[model samples]
Target: MHMEILPFTIAVPDAIIDDLHTRLTNTRWPEAELVDDWSQGAPLAYVQEVCEYWANGYDWRTRETALNRFDQFTTEIDGLDLHFIHQRSPHANATPLLLSHGWPGSIVEFHKVIEPLTDPTRFGGDAADAFHVVAPSLPGYGFSAKPTETGWGIDRIAGAFATLMSRLGYDKYVAQGGDWGAGITTALGALDPTHCQAIHVTLAMGARPKLDKELTPEMHHALERLQFYRDWDSGYSKQQATRPQTVGYGLVDSPSAQAAWIIEKFWAWTDNDGHPEDVLDRDEMLDNIMLYWINGNGASSARLYWESFGKGTRHVVTIPSGFAVFPKEISPPIREWVADSYTDIVRWQRYDKGGHFAAFEVPEVFVAEIRSMFRRYRPGF
Candidate 1:
C-alpha cells in the first residue's frame, strides 16, 4: 500500500475564529454550582473566566505558530488521514520514538519535550542521548480523521501506529504513552514485538493483581486509588463509552461546555494545589482545549472509549517494558502487578510529584525517564 505523506500546517480560517468568538459571547450559562469546590464539576465562575479569556485575551495565531515551528505531516493509514509531528535528531544513530497522546490531550502535550528529546545537546544533554521523535495525534483527535465505522479499537489503533512507524521508514522503535495512549502502546508491544523494541508507559492496565492473596502496602494503596477512580473519576469514561454523541452535541456547539468538560479533568487528575493553574499555565491549558474545540472532536474523540474500553481481549506483552509511576495519577499500579502482564520489566521508577499528564506536567522528569529507560536498549548508555 502506497502512503502519501504531505506537509501539513495549522491554518484555521479567520471566519472560524470569528465564529468561536461569537459563540463565546452568546454562551447560555447555567446557575453557579451550589458548592464552592470542584466536586460538582468545573465551577461556573472558572468556566466563564476561562471562556472569556479564550475569546478576548487568548491568541490563536501565537499558538498556531508554536505548533508550526516543528515539521508536521498527514498521511493515509487504514483509510484514515493520520496527523503527526516528525522531528529527526541530528545524530545519525538516534533512536526512533513514537509518542502517543491520550484523551483531553493532543500533540500539544509533547511540545515542551520534543526539542529536548530530539536534540539533547541543545538542552545540556549529550548528543548520544538524542532521539528521532514521532508524536502523532490519535485517530479521531486533533487533525486526524475520525473513524466513520466501528472497529477502530485499541488493538486496531496499535496496528495502525505500527504501520505508521514502518511507513516512516523506522523498522525498530520504542513506544511511550499514558491514559488511552498507554493502552495503545501496550497493545503495540504485544502486536508488533519484533519491530517495537520496548515500551514505556505511565499507565499500566491489564495487570490485575490477585486480591485473594495478602496485599503489600503499595498494593493496598494501588487498590484504594483504583477503587476511588472507579467510584468518582470514571464518570466521563462511562459517558463517552456509552453515549458519546449525546454529550458531543453540547461540546461541539458550546465553547464553554467544551472548556468545562476538559478543564475539569486537568483539575482533578493533575497534581495541583487548589487549582489547575498551580501546576499548569492557564494559556497552555487553553491551548490544549482549543485543539479539541477547533477540531470539533468532542464526539469523535469520545467514541474511542466506546470502541475499545471493556470490549477487547487483553494481550500480554513479552517485550522489554518500563514504568514511571507518577504520584497523583488516578491509576497507579504496583510493580508486582505490572510484572504480571509485562513479562520483561526492565525499569520501574516512582516520583513524588507529577500526575497523569506527565509530559505536560513534568517535561524534564518525563524526558529523563524516557532517556533512562531506552538507554539500556539503545546500545550506548
Candidate 2:
C-alpha cells in the first residue's frame, strides 16, 4: 500500500478550541455531598483549575510544533490507516525496533525515550545499541484511524503491524510494549515469529497459570498481586470490553469527562498513588490528553478493549517474550507462569517504582531495561 505521510501539522479548527473553551466556561459540575476527600472524584476546584488552564493557559501551538518535529506518517494496514512515528537513528545501521502504546495513551509516551533509545551513546552507551524506533498509534487510538469494523483485536493488530514492518521495508525487527501494548507486541511476535527477532513486554497481566508444581515465594506473591488486581482493578476493563461506544460518547463529547477517564487511570496505575504530578506534571499529562482529543480517539481507544475481548485473541501469544514487571500494573504474571506460553524468557526485570505507562513514568528505567535486554538478543544490523 502507498503510505500517506501525515501533514506536518494537524489542523485544529478554531471552532473546536472555542467549543472546548465554552464548555469549560459553562460546565455544570456535579453536586458534592460534604466531601473533602477524593472519594467523590477529582475536586471541583482542581478540575476547574485544570480546565481553566487548558482553556486559557495551555499552548497547543507549541505542542503541535514539537509533535511535528518528529517524522509522522500513516499507512493502510489491514483496512485501517495505521499512524506511526518512524524516528530513524543517525547511526546508519541502527537495528529496527517497533514500540507500541496502550489505551489512554498515545505515542506521547515515547517522547523522553526517543533520544535515549535512538542515541544511547549520548547517555553513556555504545552507538551500536541505538535503535531505529518505530512507534505506532494502535488502530482506533490516537492518530491511527478508528476501527470501522468490530473485530480489530490484538492478533489482527499484531498481524497488521507485521505487515507494517514489511511496508517499511524492515524484514526483521524487535518489538516492545506495555499494558495493551504488551498484548499487541506479543501478537506481533506470535504472528510473524520469523520476522520479529524477539518480543519484550510489561508483565503478561493474567497470561500465566501453573498448577503442575509448587510455587516459589516470589511467584506466590506475584499471584496474590494478580488476584488483587483482578478483584479490584478490573472494573474499567469490564466496562470497556462490554460497552465501549456507550462510555466513549461521554468521553468524546466532554473534554473534562475524557480527561477524568484517562487521567485517573494514569494516576492510579502509575506509581503516583493519586498524585499524578509526581511522575508527570499536569501540563505533560494534559498534552497526552490533547493527542487523544485532537485525534478524536476517546471512543476508538476504548474500542480496542472491546475488540480484543470479543475475539479472545490476547490469551494466545506464542512468542519468545520478556516482561518488565512494574509495581503498579494491574495484572502481573510471574516468570514461571509466563514461561508456560513464552519459551524464550531471556530477561525479566522487576521495578519497584513505575507503572503501566513505563515509557513516560520512568523513561530512564524503561530505556535502560530495554537496552539491557534487547542487546543480548538483537543482532547487529
Candidate 3:
C-alpha cells in the first residue's frame, strides 16, 4: 500500500477563533457546585475565570508558533490522516521512539519533553540518550482525522501505528504512553514485536486485582484507590463509553463546557497542591483545550472509549517492557498486578511525585526514565 505523507502545520482559521470568543461571551453557565472542593466538579467560579482568561489573555498565535517549531506531518494510514510530530535527533545512533497521548491530552502534553528527548545534548545531557521522537495525536484526537467507522479499537490502532513506523522508514522502535495510550502501547508490544522492540507506560489497563492471594499494603492501597476511582473519578469514563455522542453536543458547542470537561481531570489526576494551576499554568492548560475546541474533537475523541472500553483482548506483551509508577497515579498498580501481562519486565521504577500526566507534570524525570529504559536496546548497544 502506498502511504502519502504530507507536511502539516497548525493554522486554525481566524474565523474559528472569533467563533470561540463569541461562544465564550454568550456562555450559559449553571449554578455553582454546592460543595467547597472539587468533589462535585470543576467549580463554576474557576471555570468562569479560566474561560475569561481564555477569551482575553490567552494568545493562540504565540502558542501555535511555539508548537510549529517542531516538524509535523500527516500521513494517510488506514483511510485516515494521522497527524504526528516527527522530531529527529542530531545523533546518528539515536533510537526511534513513538509517544502516544491519551484522552484529555493532545500532542501538547509532549511539547516539553520532545525536544529534550530528541536533542539531549542541547539540554546538557549525553547525545547517546537522544531519541528520534515521533509523537502522534491518537485517532479521533487533536488534528488527526476522526474514525467514521466503528471498529477503531486498541489492536487496530496499534496496527496502524506499526504501519506508521514502517512508513517512516523505522524498522525498529520503542513505544511509551499513559492512560489510553498505555493500552495501545501494550497492544503494539504484543502485536508488533517484530518492529516495536520495547514498551514503557504509566498506566496498565489490563491489570486485574489478585484476590486469590494475600494482599500487601501497597496492593491494599492500590485497590482502595481503584475503589475511589470507581466511586468518584470514573463518571466521565462511564459517560464517554456509554453515550459519547450525547455529551459531545455540549463539548463541541460550548468552549466553557469543553474546558471544564478536560480541566477537571488535570485537577483530579495531577500531583498538584489544591489546583491544576499549581502544576500547569492557565496557558499550558488552555493550549491543550484548544486542540479539542479548535478541531471540535469532543465527540470524536470520546468515541474512542465507546469503541474500545471493555473490548480490549490484546494482553501478555512478549517484548521488553518498563512501567513507571507515579505516587499520585489514579491507581498505582504494583509490579505483581501487571507482571502477568507485561511478561518481559525490564524496569519498574516508582517515584514519590508526579501523576497520570507524567510528561507534562515532570518532563525531566520522564525523559530520564525513557532514556534509561531504551538505552540498552539502542542499535548496536
How well does model 2 score by local distance difference test?
0.79
Expressed as tens digits, the lDDT of each residue in 1-381 for candidate 2 is 556555434567878777888877877776653687555556666676788889889887787777777777888776788888888888767888999888778888898898888988888978878898999888878778888878788888888888888878888899999877888887777778888988899857646577689878666766776776677656778888889888888788888887877776766678885677778887778888987787677778888888877565544446556788887776556777777568778788888887889999899998888888788655443
lDDT tens digits by residue: candidate 1, 1-381: 549899999999998899999999999999999998999889999899999999999999998999898899999999999999999998878999999989989999999999999999998998878899999889999899899899999988898999999999999999999988999999999999989999999987667877777888778777888888889888999999999999999999999998999999999889899799998998899889888988899999999989987897677889999999987888786887777688998998999999999999999999999999998566332
lDDT minimum window of 10 residues, candidate 3:
204-213
Q: Candidate 2 regions off by >4 Å? A: 1-8, 33-40, 211-217, 314-319, 379-381
Q: What range of 10 consecutive residues in model 2 has the weakest lDDT sum?
A: 1-10
Task: Give candidate 3's TM-score.
Answer: 0.98
Q: Is candidate 1 or candidate 2 better by lDDT?
A: 1
Across residues 179-216, which tens digit of lDDT does each residue of candidate 3 receive?
A: 98899899999999988999999987568877888998
Best by TM-score: 3
Ranking, lDDT, top scorer first = 3, 1, 2
TM-score of each: 0.98, 0.92, 0.98
